[model samples]
Target: MKATNKTEAQRIAYFGMKKMEKEGGYAFTEGTVSNWFNVVKEQDGTTYGVLLLEKRGVCNCPFWEENSEFGACKHIYWIREELAKEADFQSLTETDPRWLHGGGI
Candidate 1:
C-alpha cells in the first residue's frame, strides 16, 4: 500500500537500505510462494518473513505488527524494492518448488 505521509516505518526502511549498502549484515531470500520473502538483519540475526498480498504487504517484524496501519516495515519495503529490480519479476512471483523450504543468502 502507498503511504500518504512520511512515516517512521519509511525512515526505518531508508536507514536499513543504507546500512545494507554500507555494511554487510543483511540477507534476503525468496520464498517458495511468489509473494513470500525472508529478510535478515545482521544486528539481531533475526529472519523476518515478508508476504506480499494483492493490495498490501505484510511483515513478521515487531515494528510492522505494531505500525502496519501506517505502512510496511523495513523488511517488506526492502523485499519489494529488490523484487522490483528483477528483470523477471513476473516469473519470479510464480511458484518455485526449489524454495519450498526456507533458506537465507
Candidate 2:
C-alpha cells in the first residue's frame, strides 16, 4: 500500500523498524523519527523513503535538488523529529544502504 499522510507513512516506517529489529539486530527507535533518510512527496501527497549515508542525502524525491534541499530529505526528517529523543537508528547515517528501503526521485 501507499502512505498518503505523515501518520500512514509513520506506520510503514514502524513496520520497517520491526523488520529492522528482527533482521538487523536493532530496533527502529525512530518510530516517529529516522536517522538519516530521504523522502519523496508525490504529486498525490504519498511519501517514499531513502536512507541517507555519509554526507550525501541520496533521496531521489522529485522535489529534491542536490544543492537547494541539501539536508531536508524525508529520510533525514524521519529520524530527526522536532520532538525526538535521539534513537539508535538515528545515527547510522554512514551505513545507509541503497536497496531495501529505497526509491528514486
Candidate 3:
C-alpha cells in the first residue's frame, strides 16, 4: 500500500536504507524456499530480528505492526528495494526453463 504521507515514506526509507547498510541487516535462509528475510539491527551488540513475510513485505517488527496499517514500514521498504535489485540481476541471468515455456509452477 502506498503511503498517504509521501514525505514520511521517503524519510523512513532513507533512514531504513542507511541503517540496513550500516548494520549489515537482511539475511536470507539456505533452503529450497529461500524467501525468508531476517532484517536485523544491532544496538550495543544486541541483535534484533525483524521477520519479513514472503507476501507483500509484511513484517513482524513492532514498528510495522503499529504503524503499517495503511503504509509499509522502513524495514519493508528497505527489503523491497533489496528484493528488486536481486530480481533485476536474476533477470539478466539464466532462469527456470519452465518460465520460458508456458508452464511455470
Candidate 4:
C-alpha cells in the first residue's frame, strides 16, 4: 500500500514501529551528525540511511523512495521522535515548522 498523505504515512509508521518492536529493528545516528541515521533491521542485518533535511527526510530504503513526497517513513518518524527527546529539540512545538519539517536539525 502507498501512503498518500501525512495521516496515511503516520499510520504506516505505526505498523512499522510494531514490526520493529517485534523484530528488533533499531536505528541510531551516524557519528555526530544529528540529521543522519542508520536504521537496521536486526532480523536480517539490513541497513538503510535516513537523512533529515530542512523540510523533509530522505531515506535510501525503497519504501521511502516511493512514498517520501507524501510524508515520512518509519525511520524518519522514529528519528524525529528520538530527536524530540533531546535537549536541543525540547523547546520546539509539535506544530513548529522546524519541528514538524525537520528544519532545525
Candidate 5:
C-alpha cells in the first residue's frame, strides 16, 4: 500500500499483470504492455505522479478515465503496484516445479 516511489510501484504492476495472465483473466496483442512501459517520459504536473498515462488501463481501475479517478484511488493504485512488484520478483524465479497435479496444469 506504501508504494512511495516508481520502482516500488513498477514492481507491483508487473506482478498483477503476471497473475492476470496466469488466471486467464486477460489477454494482450503481442507486446502491447511491453510497448506501454517502454514508452516512458517524465513530464510536469501528474500524480499517479509518474506520468504513466501511457499505461492507463494497465491498472484495473473502474474509474480511470473518469477525470483522474483512479489516480487518487489508493486501493486501485496499490493493487496494481502490488501486482507489478510481484511479477518483477517472479521473473527471477527458476524453472523447477514438481507439478503437484503430475503435469504442468
Candidate 6:
C-alpha cells in the first residue's frame, strides 16, 4: 500500500516493527554520525541492511527503492524511533541525505 501522508507512513512503520520483532530483527545506532543500521536477515548467505541517520536515510533493499517516496521505510522508521531519544538531528545540513525530502511529516 502507498502512504499518502505522514500518518499513514507511521502506521506502516508500526506494522514493519512487528514483523521485524517476529523475525528476530535488530538495529544499531551511531549518534555521533547519525547513522542507524538494521540487522537484515540472511538471504542467500549474505547479511545486509538499510542505513538511516541525520537528514537522509537509504536502504539497499528493493523495498525501499519502491516505497520510499511515500514515507520512511521500515528500517528508517525503526531507526528514527531509536535515534529520537539519543540524537538531535533537527539541524541537518544540505549535505545530509534526502530521505525526508518531500517533507511529509
Winner on TM-score between 2 and 6 is 6
- Candidates in order have lDDT scores of 0.70, 0.41, 0.57, 0.74, 0.39, 0.58
Between candidates 3 and 4, the TM-score winner: 4
- For candidate 4, the TM-score is 0.63
Indicate which candidate wins on lDDT. 4
The order of the candidates by lDDT, greatest first, is: 4, 1, 6, 3, 2, 5
- Write candidate 2's Cα lDDT for 1-28 as tens digits: 3455545554554565445334532222
**Between candidates 1 and 6, the TM-score winner:** 1
Q: Tell me how far the alpha carbon of residue 48 in candidate 6 is from the true structure, in angstroms, after superposition.
A: 4.3
**Colliding residue pairs in candidate 6:** none
Cα shift from native, residue 51, model 1 (Å): 0.5
Q: What is the C-alpha RMSD of each candidate to the true structure, in Å?
A: 8.7, 14.5, 8.4, 8.7, 11.8, 11.6
Per candidate, the number of residue pairs that clash is: 0, 10, 0, 0, 13, 0
Model 3, C-alpha of 73: deviation from truth (Å): 1.4
Task: Give the per-residue lDDT digits (tens) of candidate 5, residues 1-105.
Answer: 545555555455556445544554232222344423221112432223222444454433432333242243332444445456556555543553523333234
By summed lDDT, the worst window of 10 consecutive residues in model 6 runs over: 39-48
Per-residue accuracy of model 1 over 1-105 as CA lDDT, tens digit each: 344455656887678666666776777888899878888776898898989887678888787777778656767766766676554434443255433423212
* Rank by TM-score (best first): 4, 1, 3, 6, 5, 2
Give the Cα error of residue 83 in candidate 4, in Å: 2.8
Which pairs of residues collide in model 4?
Answer: none
TM-scores of all predicted structures: 0.61, 0.28, 0.50, 0.63, 0.30, 0.48
Candidate 3 yields a Cα-based lDDT of 0.57
Candidate 2 overall lDDT versus native: 0.41
Model 6 sits at a Cα RMSD from the real structure of: 11.6
Which ranges of candidate 1 are over 4 A from the true structure? 1-6, 42-44, 88-105
Better of 3 and 6 by lDDT: 6
Better by TM-score, candidate 5 or 3:
3
lDDT assessment of candidate 6: 0.58
TM-score leader: 4
